[model samples]
Target: MTIKSNTRPVASAARDFLLTDSDFSRVRALIYQRAGIALGEQKREMVYSRLSRRLRELGMSDFTSYLAQLEAQHDSAEWQSFTNALTTNLTAFFREAHHFPLLAEHVKTCAQPVTIWCSAASTGEEPYSIAMTLIEALGNRAGNASVIATDIDTQVLEKAATGIYTMEQVSKLPQERLKRFFLKGSGARAGQVRIRPEVAAMVKFGQLNLLAPQWGLKEPFDAIFCRNVMIYFDKPTQNRILQRFEPLMKPHGLLFAGHSENFSYASQPFRLRGQTVYELDAKRGKGVA
Candidate 1:
């Protein structure tokens, strides 16, 4: 008698859509080409989970069919949905507490009419935090300051533009700041808070892709808060982005990165100023205080 087989088939039956290796590879390439995000091997499950919702919404049964449709339509709006689906928008108000103080000091030294670029606006928290800091630092002069908040995901930018947040989202803020900056809601909108009009006005939300050829921004910034964004890109992508950032920044401009990111490896245009904060190299940074 032959021994019974102990092995079983792979569990494609359990998944709503069959994501073959080929399908995942194509997705990885497409997103990298479009958005400059490098998906690693461990992200296969995450890629499948996020894209599966899109497939389900489109009534598709397999990744192959969905990806084929996506590839065929060069000018499809679905491309935005796909990019939005894969984007990770994690942020909180003053999440990196130290950076704000440094920014406050940096802007004080700059000329009037300060401008900042929050490269990954992400639900509006970071840019709003930057706005609040500018107000606190510059006081009445804050009227001349502005934040250009942008993200690759249009969906998040739409949410960011609303400037509303649940109480839970603002829970950690001090009572004084809460009263000063946000309007508490009531009745149907209880437990929600809307950013005050004055604070909201300081931020202009837009959609931008880091990989895009032209950012369409004419003004060079006094500071660029590209925080926590470069981690999603690979080394070459990071270098290219850092290179692009150099020309966009004022001589004394600061680049605040994520806590976990280190730019010392790419130390040509920037040097570590404090913690994850960077400033233009001294040789390249002359002429400005």
Candidate 2:
């Protein structure tokens, strides 16, 4: 996931629609206001490349007209399309492998019927991985545990709920895990695997925007997997989200972050417990009561 810093259009002469600086700025503002994603100037080319397809599909000739139509319709379905377009969903099964072992060890100490939230569940891989880890850790008791997987993108969430993957997607997984957790597809569905019914039953998928005014989630979680999601947000937005997560977490609950993220700056409520892992500050005592 190397993002190119060059802001220049791929080929100005070859582009069908013109993306002026103003148009890009509007896009940046709109996305930030809606989803709290902070886009850098380097994303200019990426924005144009992604949004140009929208223009074509909508029969829009230029960014100006497209943006104007988007702004005028406050309840437009296009807004979701815009957010989904700009969102970067890079994920895989057992990504950042170290976290799973830590998770398995941590959940063993938590109360029975452990609840975990995969806050940025991209295409079901992370949540499924969590469910697999739980099954291995809790054995028969795993039936009582659950994983709540959520993403802001509806399209990806739909795909995630299907619990199916291409062979290439599951190639890196251990053969034992592949055999135990997934069913091999047949005939027309060859080369793809479907997650076992038991595994799929352990996870529940939903659409959630972290920036929403009311999250509506009632249960307190023993662990929250919000890895890599905060990188797209600015510092203020990140801090705000962490603040919101505090009350939803059970006492001594763990917060797993991406390898590149650091929450030490927000030391009032969280402290680094391991590599990119955070726990409620001991002094905070029982999580934001």
Candidate 3:
């Protein structure tokens, strides 16, 4: 038997919220305040397309009232819905593979306890990759290495903490690494696997709004991976975020950004040492040793 596919477009009210510039502006601001993402003029339709679901879900008539409700609530579950709608989380295991080899090499030379921060650690693959790299490089000393994984989205973070994934999610991992680090599920838990307890323990996950003036980190990190996240912010907010993050890096510590992000504006404080990587200046004092 053969199945025939239907090509008729489904009816949608998705465009209803996006038809007005005023609605676009409100949405742009909400995204900026919540996630430091700037929606440009051309993004009016994109904003409308993304947020119309909230209008339907909240049973609101239009984007204006929905945005007003979002603003009125001091802290609401709607923010999660808003963020979930607006933010783009395109991440995979060992993406930008160059960075992992760089991490392994760097860890081999470090004498002190290493703490690496994966700033936009969506779903935890990056931090887990860091853990695996540190283990490979430092061997018996891997226990001394720690990774802090953060994102503004709490929903993904909860999933990251569980470290359970379908086979496809673990497909990129080498067979040996996969077998070493993941425990395969069976029976009712079939087709899923969880990270080994030791590897999972190396990471700490938390919610962070990078735009906030004060980040609650108690110690400086030896390295920071803020990759693929800065493209969303405007220049000023990007500069502000860099200013805030710079002080938290150890002198001579490494900072890695997305391939598209650059530190040219903040070059006086950090020297661009490699592709999307910067090093804190020697003038900065030894931080949190």
Candidate 4:
């Protein structure tokens, strides 16, 4: 008689996703077209770590298959998650401190109501900073201002709209502004603060892609804060985005960008007026009509 035989198959370890050149190119193109960001070879690990999460979330075991789904599926949650995961949200209250004084000066020069656009407002700090600046500038006159804050990242926008931030996040805020505009958390709410309604009301947060066909603004702004955003874009994308912003600014309106960003290739519509600011010289155009 022969003894019965028992056999079991061995399982393999999880596959490591090594991005191929084509995979890199595909993801770069997709992110560029949708979010206006350019990834250099240096960001290989960033692409892998960020995009790998999307693959895992969608139950895709490989980057190749995940990318195929990203291309074919018109409404894929993976694509949305990829965008949310990849965006850089480096921000804090009173960031790049110099900008506040400039904003105060601009507000002082204007006799009319002020409309400020905080483009690329990550998690709401920049727009909130603008509001605080206006509050300091306008004082009792603060009611005459509003900030239109927009960003392409919906996840960040939602967090921004809530106007809640961790204590570490608000640590950079000036003491007076912190006391005046924010409410510190209690027991269960430790390590958090909520923006006071008056300050929060002054800002309107929404989702806006700088690459969109139209900006959908009903009024041209007196000042546009697009700081620290263009660094991720290539030169051509940067030029195109700057061109779109030009017409939306009021004539002589100030355009602020990242300290590292410059409009060297931009059209003659804007003239360099300061270290990181541009002045709109083009003929004024109607807003959102």
Most lDDT-accurate candidate: 2
Q: Give the number of the best model, judged by TM-score.
A: 2
lDDT of 2 by residue, 1-289 (tens): 9554334444556778777777888899999999999999889889999999999999889898899999999899999999999999999999999999999998998888799999999899999999999999999999999999999998899999999999999999999999999999999999999999999999999999999999878788889999999999999899999988888888788899998998888635877788899887545535322
Candidate 4 lDDT, 1-289, residue by residue in tens: 9543222111133335656667777788888877888878778678877887777766777777777878998687666677777788888887778778988998888756789999988899889989988998988788979999999888999999999989988887778878999999999899999999999999998888888887788777888999999999888888887778766777678888888988866664778777888877746533332
Greater-TM-score candidate between 1 and 3: 1
lDDT-better candidate, 1 vs 2: 2
In candidate 2, which residue pairs get closer than 3 Å at backbone N, Cα or C atoms, i.e. clash?
none
TM-score for all predictions?
Answer: 0.94, 0.94, 0.89, 0.89
Error of 1 at 31 (Å): 0.6
Candidates arranged by lDDT, highest first: 2, 1, 4, 3
Which parts of model 4 are misplaced by more than 4 Å? 1-15, 282-289
Task: Estimate, for each residue in 72-125, the C-alpha lDDT of model 3 and write its tens digit.
Answer: 995998988798778777887788888888878877786668889998988888
Per-residue lDDT of 267 in model 1: 45
Model 3 whole-model lDDT (C-alpha atoms): 0.80
TM-score of candidate 2 against the unseen true structure: 0.94
RMSD of 4: 8.3
The lDDT of each candidate is 0.89, 0.90, 0.80, 0.81
Over all chains combined, what TM-score does candidate 1 have? 0.94
